[model samples]
Target: LRRQDLKAARESIQAVLKVAPDFGYAQQLAGAIEYEAGALAQAVTHLTRAQQLMPESLAARQLLAQALLRAGDPAKALATLQPVLDGKAVTPALLNLAAQAWQQQGELAKAEALFKRAAALDPADSRTRVALALNQIARGDASALESLQATAADDKGTVADLALVNERMRRREFDAALQAIAALEKKTPGQALAPLLRARVQMALKQPDKARQSLEQAAQAEPANLQAATALAEFDVRDKQFDAARKRFDALLKADPKNVGALLAVARVRQAAGAPAAEVRTLLEEALRANPTEPRPRLALVEHHLAQKDTPAALTAAQEAVAAIPDNPTLLAELARVQAVAGDFNQSISSLGQVAAQRPDSVQAQLMLAEVQMAAKNFDAAVTALQRARALAPRDFTVAQRLAAAQVAAGRPEQALATARALQKEKETAVPGLVLEGDVEAAQRRGREALAAYRAALAKVPASTAVAVKVHGALLAQEPAAAPAFATKWMSEHPQDAGFLFHLSEVAGARGDHAQAEARLQEALKLRPDDPVMLNNLAYMQVLLKRPGAVATAEKANQLRPQHPYFMDTLAVALGAEKQFDRAIELQKKVVALDPKNPLWKLTLARLYLDAGQRAQARTELSALAALG
Candidate 1:
């Protein structure tokens, strides 16, 4: 075991355990072997047995606690260590482990106090000191910088130096971080971590060429490092080297064909490169086939179908996932979501109700139930569910916020305003509550009141792009003539804010100046290239101008955000302008289906059909449009 021959050690320990199954020492050795082998569950089982066999064995108990923590059962880990922790004589290691459990449980103050106690108990233990310093930094303590510096000075180790490097990077002291990373590299020759850190800092500094070189150095220093390779591939994607990124991910898949993560990564890269939807779906399906019970691939598949507006396909995928992972709450929740999207509200409600009944104390279960109930337009039911969740978690901001929204939707705006006022009493929730008040006012058609509330929200958070956008939208809805001036002033103050620029482009379009609108949207696109809404608008403007690239632009927008009725209509317009009548008609039909009540979409469908020379279909759509009018 000391030589790191964990495989041989595991074999030897298993053989001994076969003969002395009840021996505490053998069980303890087995647990150690399994832990060193990185088989955390097996290690926990063996260590638990060892503790049961030798109740007074401190080493056995400590090992069990360590195994439990590593297995991500931090509550059980704390319970396992409680006896030793309560004793008058507790080691620094035990205190550190308990502190980690508290940290994982989100009790930051308790974790900081435990870490301080551990550090005080053993001032010479550099590991505990480093942990304490890192915890202090995470908790945003003003003394963290001093603690980190002291730990780095006293420990003279790479771990503390690395923590200091991260803190420097967070402060945007890139040059200092690079120097520290270089010093660490000199101290530990042939280490991959220093180069990786250097590459990250270089990227943050916008030195892409230098970052690539550093990443290559990291990969060369550690040929087996999957993280370095993935990082390099992500950089290639950022640089628009799509083929290069695909090749790197393909190499990873070749090494481990059944790797679900690699498959998912490849699928994402393909999507970014505008690969065909079929190809992306196939990759996700392969990942699901590789790991039938893995939720990620299943969820991805469902989302993919949903993006295409293929609700039936999404429902099928969700059903298959639940079949594979029977009785799993997460998959069941996903199933209910797909059902709700497919308009099977009764089934969705029944499924979520079963889950909420089973996990009566789970706030998340109640929240999910509330979400589906809200989606189904059962606002009162949603309020009840959210109220139940609020009862379970009175301090939960999300639950309270959702409850207010549900109250407004249920026509109880007075109750919602009262709830919003209560939220405003809390400093952390003040801005959100103000926004909710604006939404409630807007829902009641009190446009002036809504604008006032939104302006108040923006006043409180002047730098918040989101609140600013809300204020701009409310201005356009309440007073259109004032929108352009407000947007112009906002752009002057925040030139790089893409959302405001997009809204400015909308105002220009509303004024019938398509050229100016297109130019503004193009500027916004430069800021956020993959913004589907901007792409759709630009494509529509291009179509109106009879531009040559509208078809490609519209297609790219559809690829980025598939299945939206409006985006689909824009693509159809662009396609018809380019004389791709067949595809245009096909897409327009789907758009009409999604928005059947919209006479404009029906008119567009009639035009596409006529363009495709399908006179019967055109007449049918025109008749439908006439009926709508």
Candidate 2:
């Protein structure tokens, strides 16, 4: 297994398991082999059985936890690690695994502390050092970058080097990323990942031609590299070269007919080209039939049915997938989602309840059940489920917050208020608790109490745009005139808060102060120049003001958030204002298609057609709009 001969190792383990079916050691060996082979479901099942049979085996527990983490069940992973974590024999490896589980749960502070402890225990362990550096980087510690770079330079491993490359790419150092990729390629010769990384870096540098060349080279060097082939096909689709895209997909299918990615890509291309729904559905069904236990194809099939508004079909597909993968959490979640979409709230609740029962140690499962109950307006049941989750994770802010929300929804405002106040006693939840308290008071129409809570939260985190937004909103709801003054004062103190500046712009726009709104938005752009929402708002404002640069501004906004209906609508309106009716009509058609039930967008599409002198198209759109009404 350590030599990477996973297939041989799996076969050897299976032979041992076949002879000694009840032997705990054989089960453990099989589980470890499967885990290394990336068969997480098999790994989890075998490891669980091994743990039950050999209850004292730390190896079984740790391997099971690792498998659960890889399967995206961090709650279960943490639970599996808890016994070891609380024991006297705690190791750096156990701490590192627990840290990863905490990180996945979004408990950054806990994860950081655990990483520090792991690093302290194993100061000579490069992996622990690398993990600590990564955790620090995630927490926005500036010194972590140097630490990570130093670790990467020390030749710790490929993982640390890749981490450095990822960090460089995330920071938009494309040139440095390319150099890192080049170094990695030299260190590990003939790796398909190198060209893929170079291609991504080239694309980030806006060298599309070079990126395409790198992709093609990678595809040629590694014929089985599906990522390279898929990316090239996506590029073809983007350029409207439908035939080229189909050919690429066909070649991929010819090489490996059971390839789920190729199958899904072909289905998406057919959908994009306005093919018959049956044709696309056929492709999705084929993918599902090819890989019954794989979640992606089944989920895609269900999503395709839902997108077509065939709730019955979606539910049936989801049920079939769950029947095939009965123990899989992802497929079960999808089943619940489909049931909820079909308005069978009781069925959704039952499905999630089964998951929670199966994994009683999983806080996530209980939380999911609580969410479904809340959606069904069964607040008491939601609260009950959340309380179970809270018992499992007593210090979890999310579980506590949800419990408070459920109490509020159940009309037990006093209980909710008590929960909120308790949260304020914890350092981790203090500000969020105050915010929640304010929300509860505002919901109950206790205006003064709400204001006081929001003000206290703002005092704790003076630069928090979210708390400031809540304060402004509560003030506005109670006293509209005073709200504007508060926003002005807050903006004066936190001049660099682009989010609050944008909020102030919205207030200015509502009061017919377009000049003030525009000035505020311009100031916000200086802080976050590429913010799509701000760009969209500024474009809409420019269109209303009849500014000549409106089309360009709206184009930039749409480019920033491609295929977003709101941004597309703004661009369409701006184009129409500039008398670019043809493109406006084209864009509006897409916007209306994206939101077919929106009469306003359809009305705009009709107007655009009329402006472009296509009276027949305009009449058709207007008639459809009337039918909608």
Candidate 3:
């Protein structure tokens, strides 16, 4: 077994078990083999039998406890170890196992105490010290770095070095982590682990190309390295190379038929590529079946249902996951998110409150609570939650941005502007802050100030589609003549930008140049032929220009966005231009029905009826429009 001849060891263990079915040592050996083979549930069953057969054997009890923990039943692991613990016969191994079980159960204080006890019992043991350092790191103690570094230095090429790298990652000390990885690579040249660690650190540092190269190097160096291959596949998915990722994951599945990570990765890639939801769900379900104790597949299933807008299914999945891991903050947070999306705001808040109580320092939980409150239109409550989150993570730009947005939603534009200005002072390129400032200025009816703010943002982030659109819209609203030159200059610089071309078209239409508007719209459509808004605009301009096939273009736009009233209205106008008054009236009436309160739709409907010579319907619609005044 120590030599990793798993097949021979399993056969020998079975023979021993067959000869002495009641022998505790044979049963324990069988259980250990199953555990090493990743058959955690079978390991638990065999180890339980061994423990029951030899209730006084501490080794059997320890093995059973370890198997139970691996099977995701940490409570059962603690129960299994209670006799030894209660009898005061605790070894360092037993203490470590108990600490791990407690940690899995979310009893961090008890876990840390047990870890400290284990380290004190064996002060020279690097593994126990590494465990204690990991516990301190989890609690955000920077002092853990000293201990972790010492362990890594003393225990080269061991798991301690991996823990040191992980601790550095948790602290976001990417450069230091990379240095340690470099040292480890130098120490153990040609090994895949160092390259794999480098890839992970590179990814965390947002150097995706470097990370990809590193992952490729690791996979090439060790063709059997499942971790490196899986990371490479995930990177492909992130890069939207779905076909390549799927092929690689399929090869992995062929190598290990029940590879749950490969199944989950393939499902995620398929989901991102907009594959059929049922197909993605089947893959996730298969992964779940392969590893019932794993939470990732279950989480993916919930996310899949949520993405499909099957909120009820999502809620059910989330509830089941929370039930399975009641103390897990991540699963609880997922349940809260599902509840919020399902419109059960009260339940979502209750769940979030529980998570906040359990994990008081979790900014994610507080942020989720804020999101739920914002969705409920309780903007003031959202502000409070966001304030808490900001207090917890004061340096997080996202929390600050969300807080400003929430303040704006709560009708505190001045406060929002103040926050945005403060953020702008802190950031070197404050495009988001400038955008928010523009929004607040626009909301206050300061058109000139809003335009200036938007222009400033555009200057900082010239390639930002959103900022460019805001700048163009603000310019058009405040200074129509300047809008054309601004848009034309931007278009010259960004010839292939369909949005800039669309903006130019809008400017042309505003200046009553139907020919120029139609030309610009056609150019924009060439760049983004499937954009329904561009098609609708082009169709509308074609009708105004009295062009041939205007009706066909309008119909195509309407087909692309069947539920859009504006698209329907454009189609009606094209039909009316072609002397199809009855069909035009029908389409106009559908538009009016969609937005009964819109005076524009009512007026259009009245004109359509008048054109159709329906005096009674036309008079009724005219009276309704008059009443709207």
Candidate 4:
């Protein structure tokens, strides 16, 4: 069974059990076979019977405990191991099993102690050392690499070699990892482990084609290897073969019904394919039911709710996940993300602070805190957190970019410009730095310098739509008469870009050429027929032109994004244009309710009431807007 001949092993065990039904050893063997076959419940039944028949059999008890843990019942596993733990038998195997149970229960300190004890008792046990090394790695100890290297050198087996590959990857030593994986393949020819490790290393090196080929080879070499199959399914997802990924995950689930990875993978694929929300929800809920203690499905549920824009539901799911794994920094970080998205910025900051406090050296945690602070417009706090992150990851470009942006937001444009220029000098491609320079110069009203910066960026990356938009906007702001000719030339070059057409419409509007504005918006609409923003803009232009069907076009935009305040405001304007005064007033009221602090919604509401011939309501709304001022 350990050699993967499960059918033959099961048949032999069954034959022995049939001849001697009460034989404890045969029953234990049968139970082990079932466990290896992924029938956890049946394994538990047989193991329990074997324990009852031979109450003093330590091996039977150990197997039962392992089966319980695999069944996602850590509490039951601890209970099954109680006798061995209390009797002080002190076997390295028993300590290792107990350590796993404690780890599953989130008792990391106890687990670490037990793992150390086991490693001390069996000094040459590679598996025990590997487990201890993993714990150390989780705590950010670089010495874990030494332990992992020692284990790999001693064992030359799958677990230790995989650990070495992962450690190398974590350290960003992709070339070294690849070399190690190649040697592993030579040592274990035709084995799936080496190919899978090679695929991961190739992925880290950004060699997608090589990674895909290695994944396929691994899957072919071991048809029953779930890790290989999962990797292939994930690769299919990346390739946009959603149906193929779903099929693979479905097969995995059918073979092992309680496979959490398969469940999550299928849900992810469905979500990516834009499957119905209810269908994705059902899949995630089923996974939660199957493995209630697993944090992955719960976190997925939180993300799903957030994507659907159900903030309260997302918060509730995040809370549940945090409750399940209270000490996990990753889960706590996820809770912070949900809180931030739900507009609970203070609470989000508090949660993130906890994670940073727990893992002071974690760059990811510090970066997350900085991001939330920036979103909250607490620029000074963001700067402080980002400086910490920059100290930790000095060469990380993203950290540098965000720090520069935060410095600009904090009213230190000179410092931001210096940082951006330094980044431009450091990198071979300096388009992003040039863009940042343009943004800073534009903020400082240095129009000519900003234009020069933008042009430089466009020269480097001519096809960059964002750079084109920035250049066009800067030209229009500085030299309005010259803007039209620049827009015309750019539009002629990028005729298929609806976004550029929209920018042209804005430029036309600023120049008070309503006809040209309407024409450009119409052209954009033709290219992006189903885009709600395009629909809203076209409808608004039609309303301004007093053209017919404006209401219908705005209604389509509203239907596409029912909760969007801007779309609703456009629909209200269209209603007023069509002389549906009462409907328009009601829609404005809803918009005001959505964003009460917006003086624009209040002013719009007042105008709608006056047009509806409701003097009292108009006076009240105008008074409110005046109070806001």
Candidate models: Cα lDDT each: 0.79, 0.80, 0.78, 0.79
Better of 2 and 3 by lDDT: 2
**Per-prediction TM-score:** 0.68, 0.69, 0.52, 0.52
Candidate 4 ranges with C-alpha deviation above 4 Å? 1-6, 10-289, 300-316, 338-347, 357-364, 375-378, 391-398, 508-515, 525-536, 543-629
Cα lDDT tens digits, model 3, 366-402, are 8999999999999999999999998997657688788
Give the lDDT of residue 354 in candidate 2. 81
lDDT per residue for candidate 4 within 178-287, as digits (tens), equals 87677667777755657766786787687988988997887666444455666677777656688998787554466567667668778877865656678998999999
lDDT, candidate 2, 453-498, per-residue tens:
9999999998899999988988888777898788878888988889
Lowest-lDDT window of 10 residues in candidate 4? Answer: 157-166
Q: Once model 4 is optimally superposed onto the true structure by TM-score, how far is the C-alpha of residue 14 displaced, in angstroms?
A: 8.7
Model 2 TM-score is: 0.69
Ranking by lDDT: 2, 1, 4, 3
Q: What's the C-alpha lDDT at position 255 in model 2?
A: 48
Clashes of 1: 0
CA displacement after TM-score superposition, residue 554 of candidate 4 (Å) = 7.1
C-alpha lDDT (0 to 100) for residue 175 of candidate 4: 88
The predictions' CA RMSDs to the true structure, in order, are 7.5, 7.6, 11.9, 12.6
